[model samples]
Target: MTAGLPEPAGFPDCPVCAYVLTGTARLCSDCAGRTLQPVVDPHCPVCSQAVAPGGQCGNRLCTLPLQQRGFSRVDAVAVYSGALKDKIHKLKYEGRRGWAMIFGRLLVGWMESHPERMRGVDYVVGNPTHPTRQPIQHIEAIMDAAYTEDVTHVLPLSPPGAHRLVKTTETPRSANKNLDDKRTAAAEHAAALTWTGDTSDIRDATILLVDDVLTSGSQLQHVARRLRASGAADVRGLVLARVPWSG
Candidate 1:
């Protein structure tokens, strides 16, 4: 005969660790920390790529003059390595939506550390996923990041929301394409988010846009153009990770 089952919340095994989680927390901080990779290196202001301590913004793909890009600046919370990468993959494909909170909190902490970034920001907006892609994990990650940072002013741009920006006809796998191809593809299938509803109130407002990762940054650029054209005074991008170009 088999023994009785364990009591409620008794000897709960950590998902990342086989050991029991005896503490009040669900996943022990020790095991959780293993997945986190703090962005210790100085990064490029344009692309969020880690550079030398006294480095210049030399990534030609990302370091184009601010006047030419969609958003003025972009920042990432962590390097796309270790635990962060695995979690993002699982969240996108495996529906591990719970990882949103973790990525969100990390983004909040990253913003807090760099107060200069959030200065005069009015609304926090998320990059919208297509209507067909039901569970928008990146969308939630942006919202969670804003909420964790106690950011009250946010724009809802996800599915089930009436007004949205940039409805992607197809899911463009950015990593699969070259720089020129990414830029071309981004421009080809672009219908900027048009708001029939009143957005007159935010005409002069400064917006902070958030996303999960920056691969080619073609998406960010595409959206920023729409926002700027919509009369947004300024738009900036923040992401959880900056995917270095594999090519």
Candidate 2:
């Protein structure tokens, strides 16, 4: 939604290898192929940490905050690296809305592969952006493709809604900040989020939180926390890319 990026040149091609595609293309069907590599495979279901394949972490120490808060699990599509990062940047900042189709396709593929994982999803929600910024239309478009009319919802944490997720206390722009700085900003942002949804409604329903990118897992973590606090029975995160934390 940022300005001066142009309309995205009619959706974007694979940044790595230029391959024209329809709205249904998940990956470069011509050059890179249709399927995409999994992001968090062989990860601890609780903490999403890389572990032995089919391995489970029984100990509480390895549990992620979301799991401890009573959510089931978190699943991402692809690692937030390589061409994925470039595509996400284009979709988010450059107004390349066409890339959203790829993201949606990936989500649908993930859901199909792990049908049980998304079994009882009652609503599809996206990570709320600042009021000044446009809603993540990409996610909505993707969700429309993913769920159709059976499940359609958009939960905003900002204006037009009584609930306020995280508020921006500092003028520090996340994209411009270093990793540590981003983490700090995210923590501050989390503290400012206020829950205004009904505890019982959120508690028993299954909620899927969508975001464009996942870096440091701070934003999702905080949002998950607030949702759980509001009584969300299960909260899962879906992101186009998962930027690994080098630290």
Candidate 3:
């Protein structure tokens, strides 16, 4: 067996749980069973969230109209819970940098499942980060996904060291309290950042925004609004997980 290659039918190590494996395993049987959870059954097609049965967003945590809003098209890789959440936690707070690639690959796999939507997507970007943070993990993952040859939505890398979006918020937010509180906090925190990049390529191009999680979507919304202002034709969100919130 090769040094790093998976042995015969060996599965890759699960990104969430440190499941022990003999060879190059991406996901073990237990981790492979994890999947995206549908928060909204009859979700709005645009935002892709479960809305009130009557078409309004009944989620009390969100005060935006019960109608469709934000990002012309949005999709999540998995529901923000269970093993997926565990993996996301480690990726962000823990030093598990490799999880970024794992999540990025998951996003690519999700895109491959829905190839029709891949058309016209010109750029792939993640939310802006504070200059204080040393390295951005999810960005690295997106870069990896762009290079993976087997994926259907095989995207390419953007400019290296060209992190145009930078977070300006000095203090961290506390939306972890409740859903309603989260919406307000997320929106405020999201506004603290600005985009710093060349507008030449973004104009009239479809941009795929990548992120580890989608809580209130304030970050993505703020960025999309900014992108549209910069002449971007469309903005789509590709998140690793979506937290389920209720009234």
Candidate 4:
């Protein structure tokens, strides 16, 4: 039995430390502060991909100029490492669905703190996962939880629905792919993506794409392209974590 079990007043204990939560808190402030590493500076303004101090964007496959890429701007809450990584791992592999809401609430607070990133968003769309490939769609869950927790209505964003952008087919594992291979896989993955929601309202809407983590960022780029083709005026990205720049 866990020490924090039988939680008081039905509020969940902090997932990271089992500390009793007060107010509407999810992970305690201490845990959040300790685990969430800020994105390293000198990142690409367009995709939020980390870059060397004096070097260019780490994404080698991104040939298009900043203004021409799928998303106008992309931001992430933290670097994907330390305890936060473990939390994400549990959420994805251990069926810890409750963490989705916690992560969502955290995102709400993050968006609140960084107003510019979400300035004129119309819809918050989750990067979708194929049903046949995974039993649970992690990104969709995160967005749904975020929608439910945004009580203040700070950002003019609403989650359209889960799997709004569907992954029609499975693709190769990104980790196994080299830079050239990642680019190839990303292109194929983009071709496999399809939007499943109504397009009329989003014709010129400024949409925000939400995802769990930013790896190669090809997925978000693909989704953004699909949305752009569908007539979205501007598409932005907000991810929970980003892989730190190696250079």
Candidate 5:
């Protein structure tokens, strides 16, 4: 099938595993079978995590940090574990940028499956990475693949040189951190964020913020808040993965 614009003549390899593809298949059968574990039913409507029988949605508590973020809702494609997590690590660390194609396909498929998620969303934006941080912005690649053909959701994928949002200072990693530590990191990240574009489009618009994963949600919290402050009427999240609540 046709790939991202300028619409490649053909896609010859499985993006996830780099296996040679024979037909229009975007991913190898092996990789397809093992990955893309979508979040399913009996889940929280707010956070989309699985809800135990007769127990409340774990996120029902008002004190949860995500509740206070600018976004009103979050929809994720899968739980961040197993094969999916491994592939994300490879994409982010090993420079396997091609895997973004599979992620884009997954995000597109998720949007199709849940049509309501796109309702009234004016733009779909990937979380911008700092220019000095990496050789390629992985999130932008995924967004390009997912919405390239559909301009309704697509915005020009921000290159390193021109990002609407810039991370002014590097913050501590959030992995496995305590709640207080995560908050500290989020504060630092938020404080360092800068806006670099015309706010005319953002005014009274509803935005769908896309990201690879949601851990402590420090990244999304700050980005969404900035967007809201720029006059985004509503900001929602569409993430590829969510770490299952460890509590």
Candidate 6:
């Protein structure tokens, strides 16, 4: 639980089934045998839409102009609902920092299984936390503990970089808002963001941007566009959860 103490490689037992887990095991090695599922089911690789099986939509919603600009692909480990949402809420606000280790392990496992999606990644960066928000050092610690030999965490963003992505002139707490309201607020906030970093470092770099969840994806899109503008060769997103659009 301390910052420097090593996080456990995996959860001690299956949170759902109470089955004992072995070292580094993700699922309950004995019970129902349901492995963690990736969010790749008939979803659009660009926008994460749950398209009909074998169906592809080449329309603007599916093939937004941003997709063609710089970001090449997007992938997620789980849907942003039910157990996943509970876990995220716990990690982000409820002091259950241990959950981050499990999430990080899941991310590493997914990347290993789908190496193609990880192509061109030069650095791993989590979304910057706002100045008014709690420091994400614990999340970074969890990532450090769970990081495989493949991925590397880069420098933490300063207050300026974090604030640069703020869009709405008014800073609002969104914990209680509905999805549509959150999306609207985020989009409005993103439009107000202005880059101030020396983007030269990201130029020609393939950056793997990590976030806890993907809701409307407006936030991710806004940040990815800025990265591209700064000369990043490619920007790919790895979110722990994806909230389905319920419209």
Which candidate's TM-score is highest? 4
TM-score of 3: 0.70
Query: What pairs collide in candidate 6?
Result: 167-189, 168-189
C-alpha local distance difference test of each model: 0.60, 0.54, 0.58, 0.69, 0.65, 0.56
What are the per-residue Cα lDDT tens digits for candidate 1 across 1-247? 1127343221112343332322212232233444456455676767777677896755565666555586887887666776678878777777776655555545555555566788887666677666566455466544654464344423232323433343546656455778787876666534534444468846977788888887667778877777777788888988877776432
Query: Which digits, one per residue and each the tens of the lDDT, describe model 4 over residues 1-247?
Result: 2245543222124543434323233333223544468777787876677777887885743667544568777788778887677778878767688788778777876776666777777777777666665546777777777777776655554553644567888877566768778767766777887767686877999888888888767767767777788889998888888877575
> Residue by residue across 6-30, what tens digits does model 3's lDDT show?
4333212443333332211233322
Question: Per-prediction RMSD in angstroms?
Answer: 7.2, 8.1, 5.6, 5.1, 5.7, 7.0
TM-scores, in order shown? Answer: 0.71, 0.64, 0.70, 0.79, 0.75, 0.67
Candidate 3 segments exceeding 4 Å error: 1-40, 51-55, 59-70, 134-153, 159-174, 177-197
Q: Count the backbone clashes (under 3 Å) in each candidate.
A: 0, 5, 10, 0, 0, 2
Cα lDDT of candidate 3 equals: 0.58
The CA root-mean-square deviation of candidate 3, after full C-alpha superposition on the true structure, stands at 5.6
Q: For residues 75-112, what per-residue lDDT tens digits would candidate 2 score against the true structure? A: 66666666767777776767676666556555654554
Candidate 6 residue 121 C-alpha distance from true site, Å: 0.9
Against the true structure, candidate 6 reaches a TM-score of: 0.67
For candidate 6, the lDDT comes to: 0.56
Best by lDDT: 4
Candidate 2 vs 6: which has more lDDT: 6
